[model samples]
Target: MSIQRIAAAATAALAAVALALAGASPAVAGSPHFIRNATTASLDGVSLVVDFKEAGLEAGAVETIQVTAHLDALYQCVNNGGKVPSDPKKTTISSDVSESDEFTAAKNGNLVGTLTVDPPDAASVLDCPSGQRSTLVSVTWSDVIIDDLTSGASLALTGTFSA
Candidate 1:
């Protein structure tokens, strides 16, 4: 091809490249500007209460208790649009306890249990990429019993979370 023709074609290609880059420039590297809003919802209450069936028996008698709890994510994430990842479950309870008059009873008890859903490994949500959202945690307690004692008995369970 002629030199003039080749030079003209090269100039046109360079101009097109510059225009494309200008149109698709990278986003400014600064904190994202956001608008905040607050909303309220009724808090769902959950508790585990245990009462001793037997009042009086030998002091040495032993008793056993079984308990369980649940954790879940209730709110949807709103980001570029909106997304809801699978609600992760809490795998382990940080704290659990049973109180009784029996001498054999543990001062503080730790029990073996399982989580119905898989808990997210990280702090942020998987599907949502924007503002923070709310999640629900449900815990249940059952099959707790206290050994024979001179006085009435009861059980209590507690839990802690890792951030």
Candidate 2:
């Protein structure tokens, strides 16, 4: 009876080991972790709202996020006695900009937040030629991306903010 019990236990252990090995998978280290609840970036009025997350960071880690983008801004300028509808004095200017901010990661390595971009406002850009007045009508941002400058993490965002 003792011999039969030992043999049964050994067989069961071997079968369990075989099943566990069949279900195991290789771990992919250094891969970017994606957050499911992140919101899509949007433009609020004349400002842009950056909503996103950076994964694979230490819990409560303080990090700097850098944003680089191409911007197309439309400015309406008053032309000296220019035709009202026929000669709408509007100018479209394009530029590349880089911005940065710092934040702390969550306990689960997700750094999430909303960034409001409204500064670097070029009211002076309204300084039109020939004593004309100008105002920024609208702006379009493209190929916008965020990078974890502190941790050197991979890209986290690539959304276009336009009205």
Candidate 3:
């Protein structure tokens, strides 16, 4: 299976699972791991909960970041007790890369994409807190477009992981 597909499945399954922090432990190099973070955003009648997974990392090493944008629920103001359009399954969420878009989400709400975390960004997002030793996955949904919207199409989110 494609990497994206694998990531999507993992993300969906672990959406509600939280990983406990190891409490100020030194990050071991060459170890694969998972970090989870989430943020909520709303516009018009639709609400989104953006979940992030920083996976496949070895301490300060750079790796792929998985993003998931979920439609809060089927019934909302626009839908008026009805389901949203049948297009969320086709909606694509991308991570910004050097003035371009990269890492589109898969069909199952898993934007299975990898981002190379540079030194500066890495220092902020990947660095664990004083009493924590887990990666922080930051996700800013500035340009994520939910195509095939009939109205109230604008959607944006600033979901960052706090240290």
TM-score of each candidate? 0.23, 0.63, 0.19
Q: Please state the error at residue 16 of candidate 1 in Å.
A: 99
TM-score for candidate 3, residues paired by index = 0.19
Q: For model 1, what is the alpha-carbon lDDT of residue 16?
A: 100
Clashing pairs in 2: none
Best by lDDT: 2
Best by TM-score: 2
**Every model: Cα RMSD to truth:** 30.0, 8.4, 25.8
lDDT of 1 by residue, 42-137 (tens): 122443333223222233334443322233333244333344445533233433333433233222221111112233323443333436343424
Let me know the TM-score candidate 2 reaches against the reference structure: 0.63
Summarize candidate 3's per-residue lDDT along 82-137 as a digit string, tens digits: 33334321112234422112333232223323322221233333333243332213
Q: What lDDT would each prediction earn against the true structure? A: 0.34, 0.68, 0.31
Report clash pairs, candidate 1.
Answer: 69-140, 70-138, 89-118
Model 2 per-residue lDDT tens digits across residues 1-163: 6999999999999999999989875332344443545635577876666677778777777888766667788877655564333455676778776767888887777788766665245455555556555667778887666667777764545667776
